[model samples]
Target: MSIREKIVKEYEFLKPEMIKTIGELITFPSVLDEEAVETPFGKNIDLCLDKALEKCKELGFKVFKDSKGYYGYAEIGTGEEMIAVLGHLDVVPAGDIAKWESDPFKMEQRDGKLYGRGTQDDKGPTVIALYAIKSIMNIGLKLNKRVRVIFGTDEENLWRCINRYMELEEKPSMGFTPDSKFPMIYAEKGLLQFNAIGKGESVVLSGGGAYNAVPDKFQYKSKDLKSLEEKLIANGTKYEIDGDTITVFGKSVHAAVGEEGINAIKMLMLALKETGVATPSLDFISDYVGNDPYAEKIFGVLEDEASGKLKFNLGKVEINSEKSLLGIDIRIPVTISKEEIVTKIKNIIKQYGFEYEERDFLRSLYVPLDHTLIKTLRKVYEEETEFDSTPLSSGGATYARSMENCVAFGAVFPDGKKTEHQPNENLAIRDMDRAFIIYAKAIYELAK
Candidate 1:
């Protein structure tokens, strides 16, 4: 039988197993955290590792858990050649369940789609890849290589899971991550997170967290909020008033793709200018919040890169007797230098005599399109689906960059909508079965 036929047949046998695995992963709220809290980031990660280890052992693949709790594998063959498949189980925090069609944690299947948080961003594709390995093994295919799938538990946070795994494992020859879109991805933009504080009148606000994530809610208090509202309206800005509490409506989006939407910080700045708190110029706040000269000279730059508009969120606000701290959050392009960006921001603050400090800085990551693994996967995508999709770039981050020779492959299709990190996230059931066959073929090709 043709490889495609064999793959489709194998996927039919693998459907039940795939569904059960995804359901279990979504049940755990594995968002990232630094502090060792009871339900901290990887609270149920060990449990996931246990499940993966059990299955890997059953599939005739040797499993290894690192000292730091990350897991690895050894799917043995000959010639000292190796192939890697990367995937993550940890998911982003589910926000505003009221916006969801169903529980974000519970896996729901409707109209050929499975709805849940990790169902698309990663867990779905990850399971498909594992079963791909199983299908290849079940067929007793002999090849000249070994394929190993690595499950990371902290990809949404610091990527410590894969970092720890590398400390105990050898790098693979080539690999693909089944987490992104199809046709394939050839380039991925870098990411950076920064904070800026100024010494204007202070406001009282709190409850924003995760620099890479959009804050669910935040509120600020200013003695002159009435004037603030007037200034905002005068400046062609938008906002909401609640008694003495001024709530600026900041658009929320995943940090990787934040540039595509309106930022909360800019709205607050406009509101401040309308109220005579700061200059209406983007530079006024950009100087305080951005890292380098880019903010100072961004007015013209906005026209060129406006397709990927940069943005910030006014996650939290607070006013006090000392000074109001505008908890401004920012996401910028990857090509910018971190120190230069910070220096420009510091310089802007010095001019206003406002003190500013950065709270978190996450580096951006990217890989080239000509990469062998990327080429191989792209070829597979074209051959299998007859779709000539090229490897594309994205603002979102993934565990693919955590290791070498890895590019994100698909559970998400191009015509497919982006529900990742958004409410009512889901994966089409037909897409799930199709992904299994694709993954199985990719694994067979990589393993051989």
Candidate 2:
């Protein structure tokens, strides 16, 4: 059998072990937590890293975990050039426990799909990549270059872990991350997260916990609950009215694709405005933003051929007697400058008497489709899946943008289910099986 066939057989042989490893890793609930001495991100994250590195050692890869718990890596082979497969272990908070059919922390398989938090967003892909390394080793493939699987714990929030990893380690010759779509991601849009703060006393509003997810639940204090209820009912929004508080419920999705989720914060603001409890910030957002996925009202139609249009999400909103704050997430097209977007946003918010503060920003990444790394990955994807292996751009940010000569290869296929940052997040067993074959082949080709 050819080396590729041998690698596939090894992956099939290790399928059970791979599933078990993913299950074990998913049970850690490795969401970012209060920092401790040894566990900088949180105890759970540190524990997850320990477990991952332990598996790496068992697979005969030299393991290294940063003392600060920022990142970890496992490597095999002997060569001067190193290729990296980057992925993250941390997951976003499992919002609304009631929404999940099973425990988000407990991995459960039903009807050929593994369900849990981090199953698709990252943890599953990370494990699959490690096993790909194992498959190559199992086949006794002598690679001319070293292959390193770098595990990060902060891709869901800030990329601090990967940032620290770059500072401490040498840059890879070239790399890909199994954190996005299958054919390949050649371009990723720029990310800008900011907070718009203003003074408001008419209502107390607060919603959303993460900067990258659409706010699924929003609650505000209002004396006109009946009027708000009427408006909400008229608007056909899901909501609950409690004594003096109103809670609106909507779907949650990754901010990069925020159009898929109904913005509960926007709905709540509209209800408040209709009920005559208008705060300036609420009125401004309700009138200007109004649940549009693109910030077209404020920024105009910003688009580029490389990464498509600008995507926007009002991920968070807070209003109290003392002050009001609007947390915004924007994925800019690759062609636009950050200053151009930031200046326009600041000027618009200033019109409403709100102060705009940038919380975080990630510049766009674009590697030509004809690049050697892109060509190699695309070939692997086409040969493995027989799908149209066209390169694509993404609104979601990944570790691929964290370093030079890197792009996001996929654990998700072209027609695969997309559950990232959504309730009942899951990964299909069949999809993972295909990804293992693709990753194993890609690694061998890249490393060799």
Candidate 1 least-lDDT 10 residues: 298-307
Counted clashes in each candidate structure: 19, 0
Error of 2 at 68 (Å): 1.2
Q: Write the per-residue lDDT of candidate 1 for residues 33-117, one digit (tens) a residue.
A: 5565553245576676667667778767877766556554546455588888888877888989899888888898888788988
Residue-level error in angstroms, candidate 1, position 196? 3.2
Model 2 misplacement above 4 A:
26-29, 35-37, 91-121, 196-301, 311-327, 344-355, 415-427
> What TM-score, over all chains together, does every model reach?
0.74, 0.73
lDDT of 2 by residue, 237-287 (tens): 999878887789999999888878988888888777887766788678877
Candidate 1 structure, TM-score to reference: 0.74
Q: What's model 2's TM-score?
A: 0.73
| lDDT, residue 304, model 1 | 18
